[model samples]
Target: MLETPYVAVDVDVLDRNLAGMAAVARERGLGLRPHAKTHKCLEIARRQVEHGATGLTVATVSEAEVFAGGGFDDLFIAYPIWPSPGRAERLRALAGRVALRVGVDSAESAEALSAAVGPLDVLVEIDSGHHRSGVRPADAVRVAEAAERAGHRVRGIFTFPGHGYAPGQQHTAALDEAAALSAADLGDGVRSGGSTPTAPLAEGGALTEIRPGVYVFGDAQQVELGGCGWDDVALTVVATVVSRTGNRVIVDAGSKVLGADRLAWATGFGRLPEHPDARIVALSEHHATIEFPAEPPARGDVLRIAPNHVCATVNLADELVVVRGGAEADRWRVAARGANT
Candidate 1:
């Protein structure tokens, strides 16, 4: 009974999600290297390892440092990190401690990383459809060659397949990954690709590993995108209705806690589990405007809000109250919260 407006993790739901993703990986014969950026908690990371995850994927050096310090030996910094000046020594130090894998999408980045940390495992990031930091699939080979010339080991190619978040896009994203890998012409490299929405659609024949982050904690966006359902969301922001107006109710949980990640196709800022028709219309730093299609929530009423994105929401909290069997069991600190840099 710590009070409302706090983050809560449903243990049972979390376990189900973990098992489901693990089963998918096993069935497809793909290694599960779940992204640690979703939770950023050491305890959750350990649980992922227990669930048969081959290793962990992180986004930044700071996150890799946190996980490595917490005894996660195998880690992949999945972001394209430009190793320059002081960062070179830190990269070298990190590589020495754990089996570190870095991503390189360009020849310059590959050369810089290779020069910084000599003879380390590297993955060429192909832009399947996200059009983000990754290089074109046709250019992956050039980047790999550059990394090799710089003395780094090119192990494989990977893509995010982020376009799968849209409707009827998972199959196309997977095909893009295949096409890109084929164009890369890198033989024997681990073909890694996947996001939560696209993981189930992935054939796994070309992919040696699947890195799906949000599967650990389904969110409102997942439900809307058809990646998951309402019961599948494992984490929620438990808030208390503080005020009521005509057709509108205000909750204590706001953008600072719930995050502001409204996708174009999302219903609202977030979704209410108990009242599916109700919508989190607006989110300020301290107030959330909830619109009720049927009825307004009264003051002191407790509410659970499923966020649009779990990873960003988790980053905003300092700790999470883990609930099991409808009872609060434990509190876990958000160990790597704000480890963005």
Candidate 2:
């Protein structure tokens, strides 16, 4: 038997998720470059590629290096990376090894990227209501031109539309992303857009590629947003009930393993798929306090809890116990875990 407080991945559910997303991308005629930061597992990444992923999107250079070293050469670091001397050297080497692209949002960053490593493929980041690290649509051209001046080729523009994460905002955020990309004049570069919530509605709206990270393993936030059903959750933290009260059951798995990323709109710290009404009310380092709606689980009863954020939860784990046909089939290393740089 596998140990408790470990991350369990249902391979059947994972394959379904991958195939579903691939079918959608094929139907939409959009390039599917899923964000790899969500799983951070080489096994999962290979499966994604096998499922017709055109390439993989990543959040950091370190993640890019890991994947590239693993022979997944087509990588796009979607974050607006500031090129320090060390990072620039790394980027330069990665470019030499693989087809590398990086995001840039400002002339200053463009210069830094170029000075550190010249003649790189750069995508200008446009702020489509996220108000994050991206330039506005109107300023996209300016940044693109600045990138050209800094010796980088402007390949396209991209946006996050992160506002879609909230309730009742997916369609609106998608519209905003389309509108922003439509308004931006970045020559004939590819227009990339998406967040997992906005990806479905992103078709035919100035997007050639979509980078969604969360669909691989539906999380509590995605469930609350109506993005996935309870059965769609592929990753969960396996824990054993250690204590019980009236309606409270304590599990050995907590934030240390499951992560603590409760969104403002989230119902609780995490969720119990086996008992949908159960709420992870409190989470300590190695304990999860769950409030069950019905009879509490007796001590020693094992359960699985879906994390609030699948990405954070995956980052916390060293490996994923991949279950196929209801058996422990394999253990996939979280190869890119803690690659936050």
Over 4 Å off, model 1: none
> Backbone clashes per model, in order?
0, 0
Residue-level lDDT tens digits of model 2 in 1-341: 67899999999999999998888888888899999999998888999999899889999999999999888989999999988888888999999999999999999999988887888998999999989889989998888888998899889999999999999999999999999999995767789988888888886648888999989999889999999998999999999999998999999998899898988989999998989999898999999999988889899999989999999999999999998877899999999999988
Q: Give lDDT: candidate 2, residue 323.
A: 89
Candidate 2 runs further than 4 Å off: none
TM of each candidate vs. truth? 0.97, 0.98
| lDDT, each prediction | 0.88, 0.91
Error of 2 at 258 (Å): 0.8
RMSD for each of the candidates: 1.2, 0.9
Local accuracy of candidate 1 as per-residue lDDT tens digits, 1-341: 47778999999999999999999999988899999999999989999999999999999988998899999999998989988777778789999999999998888988877766677899999888888989987788788888888888888988898888877777888787667666764997788888888887777777788899999999998888877888999999999999999999999999999999988888899998878898888899879999988779789999999998999999999998999988999998998898866
- Cα deviation in Å at residue 255, candidate 2? 0.6
Using lDDT, give the best candidate's number: 2
